[model samples]
Target: MKIVNAKEAGEQEIERLLTKAAFDQVELNPKIREANRKLFGRDMSAAELVRQIVRDVRNEGDKAVIHYTELIDRVRFTPEDFLVTEEEFQAAKDEADPDVVASLQKAAENVRRYHQEQKPKSWMTYRDAGSILGQAIIPLDRVGIYVPGGTAAYPSSVIMNAMPAVVAGVREIIMMVPPKNGKINPYVLVAARAAGIKKIYKIGGAQAIAAMAFGTETIPRVDKITGPGNIFVTLAKKEVYGHVDIDMLAGPSEILILADKTADPVYTAADMLSQAEHDPLASSIVITDDAGLAERVAKELEKQLADLPRREIAQASLDRNGLIVIAEDMRQALHFANVSAPEHMELLTEQPFQLLPYVRHAGAVFLGAYSPEPLGDYFAGPNHVLPTGGTARYYSVLNVETFMKRTSIISYTQPALSDVSSDIIRLAETEGLQAHANAIRLRRK
Candidate 1:
């Protein structure tokens, strides 16, 4: 990727580049708009497909689930053997490396500690007039977590996604992951067992989501679903939202670093590659005020790219979406960062604390070069399941709250009702809802 100086670029040129840098578009401005219009005009075929899957699984029960699992994941799993048995768990536990298991144990403890601080306590208050109001913080009855188990198996994902629900006092946590050639990954099975997951289902893709949302004969319905997946899996969550609560319709990963001359180019480049390696759509952007610093970071990116196991994917992502823009000052750099609202923001500068006040949006902010994105991804206490594709402007990282629901608690005494009756009737009458007005007025009478 070419290093561009933001201050030197003219208004039109900067605008064009910024527009191009955005993910919602690929081509020129007019072409990008046209493409968006075309995409939105199309039918909801994907949603329709999900609906059909939900209907079939709900009606046909375990039979349709097996059929879809075979058709989608290309794995044969009879209902009898779909659930992970005690023997399988023991074998997986025995198969996992001792050091790896120890690391997972430590990470799980950290995750639990961080999330436990987020737990909500129920509170109630009674007034002198005999009115009481308070909310009860209760975990969902059951929660389903979808972990990707294809070319890679993330035991860390299992720990991060399920531990919060477990700590929240969820009744049961059922984990669904695709099996490879009808066999689940030993490490994943070990992780699930270690995390205290009771039910592990050998199924994945949109089919698993449907079963979790609507419930089949074998897989029980869950009150909430949480985890990250591919595009198809994310779209499925969007479709099944009302059926069950979902964490978020997450997109590809992203990271934006605000670095200065004092920052380490090698560390910044390595962090960018960490996010880019997640997927081809991932973005790794660095905004700095020094042209020389930007060039060094780019060089470090090239050096680091050669060492990555997923270099092909990460290189493609950087070539397409990655950028190094040199700004006139740190303030200007931060302005662009806020506009991007990256899922991960690394403030790799001498004055990271000062910059923290300027950062208004981001899923999580990594304070210094030592605090890398992967720390939060696996070991750090905060959630790694973050909002991506600029959704950080509105959404937040997953936490214990994701697995819990809230209801407003409202109670009013006779005096309270009588005091507000006239104003309520006035507003209700203005809206032409006499029934609503009468509901309050009758209580007063």
Candidate 2:
């Protein structure tokens, strides 16, 4: 990991250090290009390849999804094989470990309760006599959630993404996951079932997103798509934004810790490695004023890395993206964290709550050493699908409102129209909207 003194680092150097790993066409890795060459007999960026796949699925529907599944995933499936049958669900239930299933059910209940509190109710108020202005909260008719598969199965993702929609009173929640050897992960299936997800599809990647956004013969079109996936999936979500709503353009996981001498070096190092193990692109950074604590955390990271099952990936991530900065004081460390706008931020200072008000940008803030990032990821009753790539400055964690739509309600009696007609006409005329002015003029007449 790189270590630097923030007091001595130039502003531009700090900015470059905080910049996210770019996912644009120009940043396409050699492996992605190699895959494109093997698949298409030509070099193509991930964005271009996603565009082609999205276009094919939009135009060809089920046939295109099947074709891409065979070509990209080396799995052949007909329309009938697209949907996971009740038999498969039952099999997954039977095959799943009873203890893990029970634990998932408990986690699902926690998630369900948390999101239930976030559900918004429709409300109205009559401020003027004979006039009604309000908002109607309506759950989406159907939503599609994409759970990542292949390298690993994320059953927790199913719980995190599905529970919010379920709590929002969505009529249907459709889940899609990549299949391995023509089979979806039993744990994922068990999690979906526990979360009240009725419909499951054995599909993944950009094609799955395209299928949901545009709809195939077997897959119904969804009003929105949520959950995280690879670059192709992210690009596909970007392409289909107007056609369907998406949660956010998620990137690799990240965590930043602001610590002081009082912070436990062991706990801080474990928290950093938690995010570092997520992906090779994942970033784990620490900013502290205590030089001795910084050195201890560094040594602790080395000791912890040896025991992690994903040590190679974590080590690569720490080597390439991790950083330890010696700040002048706590104020400077907090400033650095705000500028980064990390997906997860931990306050390991002596008085974490005292610094809480100063945290301006972070998807989620874990206060003190006890509140580890993984606690929120698994069972803390908070959504783990957070904004990445500094998007926490604007984007938010997935919640009930993400699956619900709000519509403005307007009602005006003849008397109310008469009261506002003149003002409406004046505004419309000022804007040179003759039709809008005429409509109000006729109403008055």
Candidate 3:
């Protein structure tokens, strides 16, 4: 990791350092191109490939879904094999360890209780003259959650994505995961069951996204789709956005730590490595005013990296994206953090709450030394599906509201209409909407 003095760096250099590594801006290396050529006999970008896959699944339905599943994943599937059977669910339950099952159940309860507080209720307010006006919150009919599968399965993702929808009273929660050797992960199945999701499809990749966006013969279309995936899956969600609602176009995982003299180097290094081990594209950064602390943290990272099972991946991530900056003071550190708008921000100051007021942008903030990013990812009640790639400036963490729709309620008695008819007609007429004015005029008459 490289260390730089933030105050000495030029403004242009600072801006460049803060910019995120966006997928659209990335170029495929020769290795990736060769692999693509071997698989599809063409060198196509992720976006182009996703476009073709989404188009095929939208038009050909189940046939195209099966074809792509076989082609990409090398797993042949019959239509009957698409939906997970009750037998599979029971088998998963039986196969899962009792301790792991208990942990998932406890995590599910924590997630449920947290999101239950966010559930919106249908409310109405009465105005003068018996007029009623308020907002009505309605749950979506159905939703699809994409769980990444193949090398590893994320049961925590299932809990985080499904619990919010369940809390919001969504009629149906459908989950999709790619099968490995014609089998889904038992832990993922158990997590889905714990989250109250019954509909799970044995599929993965952009094809799964397309199948959910446009209803296939076996898979039902959903009002919204939520989850994180690889670049292909992210591109598919981007393409299918107009057809179906999506949470956010997620990017690689990232975390930024703002530390001071009181911060522990060991804990800071461990937290940074936690996110770095996630993927080669993941970013981990630290900004601190103490040069001694910065050096200690850097040394600790090197020591800890030796023991991680995913050391190669974490090393690549740290080499490419990790940085330690020496800020003149805590104020400068906080300024850079807000500008970065990282997915996860941690404050390791003596008084973390004192710095909380300075946090204007961050998907999730972990305060104090004990609160690590992984805590929010699993055991914590808060959703771990956070906005990434500087989108925290506008987007939010996935919550119960993501699975709901709000309708404006408006009611007016004759006197109420009479009270505003002239103003309404004038506004409509100013906009050259004579029909709108006429409708109001006729109603008043």
Candidate 4:
């Protein structure tokens, strides 16, 4: 990790260090490009590949989904064999360690309880002349969550993505997990069951996204799609966005730690690795007032990297995207953090809560040394799915509101319409919208 002095580095240098390319600006990965060569007989950008895949699935339905899954994932299943059956659910439970399944059940319960508290109400108010105006909060009919096949397949994700829609009274919540061989991951299936999601389809990749977005003979079309995947999955989501809702154009995970003289070097280093292990693009940064603490934390990071199972990925992440900024003071540290607009902001200072009031942008804020990043990732009640790639400046954590839409309600008595008609007509005429003014005028006459 490069350690820089805030006084000499200046805002421009700091920005150069922190700013990542937008998700659309990223080029195709070489591995994915090579894979495309084998599949499509040519190398193409992620967008081109995703567009073809989406069009194929949208046009051909389940046949196209099966074709891609068999070729890419080396898994084959007929359209009838898509959805997870009750018998399959039982077998997954039987195969899984009871202790692990029990833990997921408890975690799902915590998720349910947390989301239950977040009921956005449909409300109204009485206005002058018996005019009633209000907003109605309505839930979507169906939602699909895409859980990846391998290490990224955290059962916690099932609860995190689905429970909010469930709490919002969504009629259907389905899940898609890429199958391994002929079966889905046992733990993921167990979590889906625990989260009260009945329908499970063992399909993944761009086809899985397309299947959900447009629906197939067997797969039900969802009102929205959530969860993360490889570049293809993200690009597929981008192409189908207007057809359905998406969580965000998610990018690499990131964490920005704001520390003071009172922060713990050991705890600080540990927290940094938590995000680093995710991907090589994942950023782990520290902004501190104390230069001494910076050196110790850097050394501590190297020491921890030696024993971690994912040391290679973590080390690459630190080497490429990590930083330690020696800010002049805590206020300066906070200023740099808000400017970066990180996905996860950790307050390792003496009073994290006091600092929280000044935090202008972040997907989620973890306060104090005790509240580590992993706590929010797993057992914590807050949603783990967050806006990344500095998009937190405008986006928000996946919450109950994501699955809902608000409709305005307007009712006016004759007196109420008359009271505002002249003003409305005048403003409409100023905008050169004669038809709009005529509508009000006709009602008045």
**Who is ahead in lDDT, 3 or 4?**
3
Give the lowest summed-lDDT range of ten residues in model 1.
Answer: 20-29
Task: Please state every model's RMSD to the true fold in angstroms.
Answer: 4.6, 1.4, 1.3, 1.8
Q: After superposition, how far is residue 311 of candidate 1 from its true place, in Å?
A: 1.9
Q: Kindly report which residue stretches of model 1 are placed more than 4 angstroms away from their true locations once superposed.
A: 8-59
Number of colliding residue pairs in model 1 = 0
lDDT by residue (200-307, candidate 2, tens digit) is 999999999999999989999999999999888899999999999999999888999999999999999999999899888788999899999989999999999999
Off by over 4 Å in 2: 24-26
Task: Assess every candidate by TM-score.
Answer: 0.89, 0.97, 0.98, 0.95
Worst 10 residues of 4 by lDDT: 20-29
Give the alpha-carbon lDDT of every model. Answer: 0.83, 0.91, 0.91, 0.89
What's the distance in Å from true for residue 55, model 4? 1.4
* Candidate 2 C-alpha error for residue 411, in Å: 1.2
lDDT per residue as tens, model 3, 1-445: 7787877895457557877565744445355567677888999777778899999999999999999899988899989999999999999999999999999999999999999999888889998877899999999999999998844579999999999999999999999998898889999999999998998999999999999999988889999999999888999999999899999999888999999999999999999999999888888999899999999999999999999999999998899889998888888888889988999999999999999998999999999999999999989899999999999999999999999999999999999888889999999999999999999999886
What is the TM-score (0 to 1) of candidate 4? 0.95
Clashing pairs in 4: none
